[model samples]
Target: MKSLIVVDCQYDFIDGTLACENAENAVNSIIKYINSNDIKVHYSKDWHSIHNGSFKDNGGVWPVHCVQGERGARLHEDFYKHVEKDVKRPKEDNVFYKGIDDEVEEYSAYNAENSQKLSLKDALEDEVIVAGIASEYCVRETVLELLEAGHMVEILKDGLGYVDSEDHLKNLQDLMERGVRII
Candidate 1:
């Protein structure tokens, strides 16, 4: 079975704090892809608490964003709408929330879990396609984790957002060299 992993397509990474370049376009492309595909879809979100170590307020490098229950933590409106409209979609049950622990700066969705306590790694199939925000960070880390776990991973090239275009391209190249297929 092949699975689609939508990584961190949240408001904070789009238009709020830590917004990335081309995030809007990436999100639109992701929505289109989801609408066009019949594959199983999973979403990863940064559901951080106020005390999450990744926040600047907590002595981390990033500004406070994606705090649980906050607007910035919510998925893109259009994406969420599509998820709601599609009965075939598993809705929030397929959402994997990472960065929930206050002390950890979790970047990989592989470390996330759904409300039912199912980890994304456990829920994923052998073949996975990944798309979404901050290509140099969360998306890249997740792809690496997936690869390390022996899954056949594909990256949606046009469906990626990033903080730096050069870094994004470099990461793509590095990932490709590591056997990740960029599509």
Candidate 2:
């Protein structure tokens, strides 16, 4: 069975404080892929608390974004709309939240847990396809974790957003070398 993991396609990563370049286009492509494919879908969000260390206010490099219960923490509107119309739409339990703990800085959705506390690794199929925002960070880290866990992984290249074009390309090359298939 194949599953698709949509990683951190939140407002913050799309057009909010930490927005990435071409995020809107990436999201549109992801939505199109979702509409065209028959794969099971899962989503990850950066639901950070105010005290989370990943926030610049809390001494991290990133600006305040994806704060829990904030507008930026929500999924992109278009993606959410597509989900609402999907026959095999993911339930709330299929959406995982990361970076909730103040001291923990989680870039990978691998360890993220859903509302029911199921880890991403535990919930995903052995064969997985991934797509989402900030290709150099969350997407990259999630793919690495999937590989390390012995899963077969593919990256939907057109469905990715990145903070920097050059860094994104470099990371994609590195991931390909490490055995991730770019689709």
Candidate 3:
């Protein structure tokens, strides 16, 4: 069965730290698609520590966001309200937490540079339809990893959005050429 992996579709990415206009606009449509499909859903979250690179105390581009137990760390308020109770766990739907360590800057749902593998990879165990924010960064990284692991991949065009449209488009094209489907 197809699994829908929502990669960092959090408030931090949609309307928080890395919020892009396109990403915010894509949220509802993505949610609708997930609800309508009735397929299993997975979400990856950037549960960063206080000293994460994206914080003011560190050298990073983004402002602090998605810190554990913070408002910015929470899911998009509207999306959360819409899909809260519906989210399954330990299998059908689970939140893969990343960026837990202070030094590692995790850009994908899979794993940080030195962390253990994401449970999402094994749980899905099949092709995954992925959608979420910052296409140029996390989305690109995750897609490549998924491909390398031998899974059929598809990106929901209207569901995933980008900060750098041009660069992200170029990367998407590269991924397409490498067999990641865009629909």
Candidate 4:
């Protein structure tokens, strides 16, 4: 079945802990797209612990955000409304929780340290449309991972944004050369 891979649309990536200006509108658009389509929606979340390396104590690239069971870790209330209550996730819509281990950093949903990784290659039976936050960082990394895993990746440019537009575009161009379709 066709899959919609939503990377880190959590509150932290929007306007919570580590909100990026570029990711705000894109996340809203991505949610709309998923709600409008029949394709299965999959999301990668950074559910970190207080002891995570990304914290102030441990040296890392970013500050701590999505801690498991915390308010920051919860999906945006607007997006969560779209998810069916009766439908248990991972069954109808797979959710890959990243950074659960707190030590190893996982950018791609297909790979995680604590939780089971979602096989982007094996799980996708049809077209895979990707959308979400921080185009220069997590978004870029996940897209490349999907491409490397041999799955066709269609990036929703309109539904996504970046911190560094120039750098993000360069990465996008490089991926395009490698066969990732941008839409």
TM-score for all predictions?
Answer: 0.95, 0.95, 0.86, 0.83
Q: Which runs of model 4 end up more than 4 angstroms from their true locations? A: 82-93, 112-122
Tens-digit lDDT track for model 4 on 17-111?
67777776786687667666677777677878888987766788777788888887776665666544323233323666777777787777666
Model 3 lDDT per residue over 86-143, tens place:
5633222376787887777778887532124547677675778888877888888888
Candidate 4 achieves a global lDDT of 0.71
RMSD of 2: 1.3
Error of 4 at 35 (Å): 2.8
**Best of the two (1, 4) by TM-score:** 1
TM-score of 1: 0.95
lDDT, model 2, position 129: 93
Candidate 3 achieves a global lDDT of: 0.75
* Alpha carbon deviation, residue 155, candidate 4 (Å): 0.5
lDDT by residue for model 2 over 37-137, one digit each (tens)?
87888999999888888778889989999999999999888875775455435568788999889888889999999999998888888999999988999
lDDT of each: 0.89, 0.88, 0.75, 0.71
Task: Give the candidate order by descending lDDT.
Answer: 1, 2, 3, 4
How many clashing residue pairs appear in each of the predictions shown? Answer: 0, 0, 0, 0
Q: Candidate 4: deviation at residue 10, Å?
A: 1.0
Question: Once superposed on the true structure, which residue ranges of model 2 sit more than 4 Å away at CA?
Answer: 83-90
The deviation in Å at residue 123 for candidate 1 is 0.9
lDDT, candidate 1, 67-174, per-residue tens: 999999988887756654464254667989999888887899997999999999998889999999989999999999999899999999989999999999999999
